[model samples]
Target: MTGAPSPGLGCVGAPRLLAGLDRMPRLDRTAHLGVHGQLPQLGPDELIALAEDIELRGRGGAGFPFARKLRAVSRSARARDGSTAVVVNGSEGEPSCLKDTALLLHAPHLVLDGALLSAAALGAEDVVVAVTRTDVEQSVREAVAERGPAGRRVRVVRLPERFVTGEGTALVSGLNGGAALPSGQKVRTSERGLNGVPTLLSNTETFAQLAVAARLGAAQYRTAGLASEPGTVLLTVAGSTVVETPTGTSLAYVLDLCGTEPGQGVLVGGFHGRWLDPASARASEVSRKSLAAFDAVLGAGAVLPLPQDTCPAGEVARVTRWMAKESAGQCGPCVRGLPALADVLEDAVRGGGAAALDAVRTRMAVVRGRGACSHPDGTSSFVASALAAFPEEFRDHALGSGCGRRVLGALPLPEDENPERLVVDWTLCKGHGLCVDILPDVVRLDADGYPAEASMPVPGRLRPKALRAVRRCPALALRIRE
Candidate 1:
């Protein structure tokens, strides 16, 4: 289950998570123990205190405070007679992300230590590490096997590698034996998750970072990076290479080291992240606050400096279209508004005049904060930033002129996945009608309200709807064929 850790190439100044990785690329049990030493033994209060002292924040896109989350779950568990669980989110589904993959593949034990250690502190019975890649799962599973009884408490699970499937609720649903789609409902994982128990779910990097902080303690850990946000962060540069640089490192240095030139602009964060002009990119640092000041987020730490040769307008249209398709299809804003926004942006690229530009703005407004999840708002921010980031290129498109450069697919996208079928487990099925309601065109209820067929061939376009139906079936009978 162990594999060679993915070594980052460019600027990995003052590596923390990847400490000793260059010499010891493959961190097996012995190497992990030798390098990082044993995980600190801390009680619930001490763990929360250490997290607060270090100012630990989730490295996931949202950047929620780690202490706040721990406190919430701890309080919820105490209120519920002291029962809880922990989930380590290793589902790095973004094509523009590899930091989590790097951490999980190379330093699996660090991530495990964080999750398991936290579980012990919170008195949680279960520790689940949800991953998307096979290599990562295998690596972590091997790491778990090394711990014997402790490993028994850890479960390595794989979810559908969809973009939105990384959402905490989506991972919870998948682990609960439902489809990996975010429910339109707003249920907090801290209160009820994973078998309807109070659970602490955080990103892969967050846990790994937590492990690093626990080992270093408060004062020593604060030695690196900014005083406020002390520590190193893993940046998935341009999607191909991963860099574990300190928090205060210059964004330009990382880009330059990765052989990227901020030509038109750099896309900070990932698809759901915002764009920054070249000037802003030069001014910003790796810290979250630095990027925020420039109206961008260090979300998922994905930084892509645009190449000068590609048409900025065309590239925006393509990425916007992809983001739209990646939607969960659970809300009206995403189901319609996002696709419409993409269409208008494409129209603007094709010399569709100012009216087309106005149409794009209109759709952005329509979708903003209107979805069950943050997809609509995030997608809207991405498009809006594109408009402001590259004014000249967009102005050319708006005035019925076009940027002469062709779209070189400067932004990377994931390859197509193998086609899958939907099947109902006969044991779980009870002639449920929920699937029928969601997929009226494809599925029909029998007189007894069971599916007409045991299995159905789901088309690519309607797969999201089918997945949604599979999750909503109270009987848990509907399942996507593996």
Candidate 2:
């Protein structure tokens, strides 16, 4: 588990999911069985009882209770054809988070045991494990092969790695042979998922936790964590180390243990998570309740401690721009509002003064609760929290000045894919001005009604509008280039 996914792969008290990493880095079938013992097969009711007794919750962003999901899918199955499917959302698409990858890469059997046990109890014949990386896929495949006949019903699928690709609806859609994009409408995975059947979908660590809970039973599982919240949580600390820290552990201790400190502040979650001031970060604990007390979320278990040297406003701008490009391009808020927000933030950081800073605040309010998914709201939160947490720095920048420190490029962003931009077919031009009405910001008519900038590096936010312009062009002169 310490193989790059986490450099300092240690634990607080005792590691649960990351139990035997020191002795056997990669727990093959023999070592896995020896360390964790056999997978216990529990009935549906018994499984739900164990989850409820242990107060088990998903390790994913929302932290929904696993028992409630299991019960919902169970009822749906009985109401329908007794058909249910189990999905392991191992898609660690976020660039900073790596606990799921550590678990899948090192302890694949533990995850499989949790998934296979659930599938058997649910009476579901189909089980699909969705991943993003190829090597991680190979590790899972090897684990399945080690299981032999027991792993027949389990199928592994690799999806495109993106910020929102790991969402429940997107993963479900991808499993059904469709694009890995979230549905515009709300999708109840427990009701109809993976080919129109009741499905029990959960995060990678959630399932792994379930497997550990089953082996130890609820009583033993309760012994590991506090009375308020039981069991250890997997935290991707400082974007480099993955620690199996128990709930209610001090956040400051984790950072110090991982050889980092809260400089400017701490980003408790990944990109979508909130920023806490040094005091809040120091006082905070690892549990959901503890983080929630400070209006922060223990989301995805990514505890990123920002360094003091880098400019806070510039770092926020860099992340905002990257998130704008990661938009699903589904709604107006995403296709328009996010890029607008990014532009305003960049402007504010580069001495745009009060006007740009006010624009940033206005856009934050406008984009909240206005997207098909939580993507827009998440981006808005990241900006809003930065503004709140580091007001003095932002105020200085707003007064036509900067922090003088360079943007150290501390945050993570993936390599850019082949993004599309508008292209004009000069041969098929008819000088129609229809394109101008559709894309006012992009298509400026020259002396002749033609695009002035022939090859514009179109931002991801305007791709949808550009398409609209291309379709509406009366001359059929508009085209797209990769």
Candidate 3:
């Protein structure tokens, strides 16, 4: 959970998102009034037209066009027979990301204003603001409460702080009182979501940007950032502070602002994002067009620089393990393949030679494009990019001996707050093999045809399946214990 906003939030230079943010400590109604003046009341058509004029993409990892999403939801809502719902995805599950929490905690009214504006535009009466942390939940509820009757229309739902829970469909699923997991199929949330009606779901920052753009209009908003990607973006500088910087800010400048020096590789985007070569990162700017020139993504506005003292290979290994642990474990690829990839990477990091290198390549191929969600794909990107960016370190670990440095936990991992593991009561087992039949991804049979792989963390996606398997067991052998 985020603390007081005093030191944690601000802008580096000229603040757009953070503009009028500093004057008041916390952006209450008075502070919000001082900062943004007033919410720009826009009709659905006007809002969509203004979004198109500004060419605003989502601030979320997908970088989808906001105008397109708005139109889709509007069209879907018109075609459907039920009411539409709007969701504010405030679940900042990425470990390196703090911008969403900071913005919600500080300038929450702006986010709410954007949501309400979108809800009104989409002809949606029900608005759901989903957050993960207690403080953020309280802050958003308080912000909503400040609006009186209008605020009461917005429903704030608290969610689990899992990495994939912030996913649009997952948020919808959770809000609908189902398991908070991405579906095993591709379905646009706009067409069918939130009580099975059309839903306009976007990141917290995206809504905040909408509020800013609604107030600033197209021309004024374009005055600050790049021609290709205009407006200020919120960046969660992992080692430093959460600041709202212009879209086309230089990567080197961002690094410098975060107290990082040049010639060190930086991980642009969040954990699911890629790694940039040191020189390439410095030469590039933080815009979609600019980074696309180098075939990179400016994902989620998370810029984490690699610590100079830490071994790049070791750091990758450590982060890979965490990513493996974070797997939703629904698909076979993510559940089994991630740990396999992590093991191979660790082997290569520990000087396990050519076999391990071959295994890494092979396993990466095996894991990619196999998950219900992008967890497997994103993990592959993270690992593949690390291998490409730090070839020398991989070479040293593979060819010579090792980097000789211990794995420094440069990247952050959520503390193991929930250490629950799935276990099977071997004594109660009768070799039924029922558990294997149910959740083949997480459970397998031994050579003797009994259930094996007893102790493991059940992915949020697979919990229902796991529970089904547990109950279906004739001997009542399988159980989950904390």
Query: Which is the leading candidate under TM-score?
Result: 2
Superposed Cα deviation of residue 364, candidate 1 (Å): 1.2
Candidate 1 Cα misplacement greater than 4 A, ranges? 1-11, 398-400, 418-482
lDDT for model 2 comes to 0.86
Q: The CA-based lDDT of model 1 is what?
A: 0.83
Give per-residue CA lDDT, model 3, range 327-354, as digits (tens). Answer: 8878888889999998888778666788
Backbone collisions counted per model:
1, 0, 0
Q: Would you list the rank order by lDDT, best first?
A: 2, 1, 3
In order, what lDDT does every prediction score?
0.83, 0.86, 0.80
Q: In model 3, which regions exceed 4 Å deviation?
A: 1-7, 418-482
Estimate, for each residue in 1-482, the C-alpha lDDT of model 1 and write its tens digit: 12323536444566778876878665888899999898878998999999999898888888899999999999998888788999998887787878888888888889988998899899998899998777888889899998888789899898888789888888899999998988878899999998999999999889998898888899999998899898888888877888888888888888888877777888998988888878888988999889889877888888887898988887788778778888898889989988998878877766678888889899999999789988888889988988988878887977866766656667876543554567888788877577877777678667877787888776444454566687788988888884
Q: Candidate 3: worst 10 consecutive residues by lDDT?
A: 1-10
- Give the runs in model 2 whose Cα sits over 4 Å from its true position: 1-8, 417-482
TM-score of 3: 0.84
Candidate 2, 153: how far from true, in Å?
1.1
Looking at model 2, which ten-residue stretch has the lowest summed lDDT? 1-10
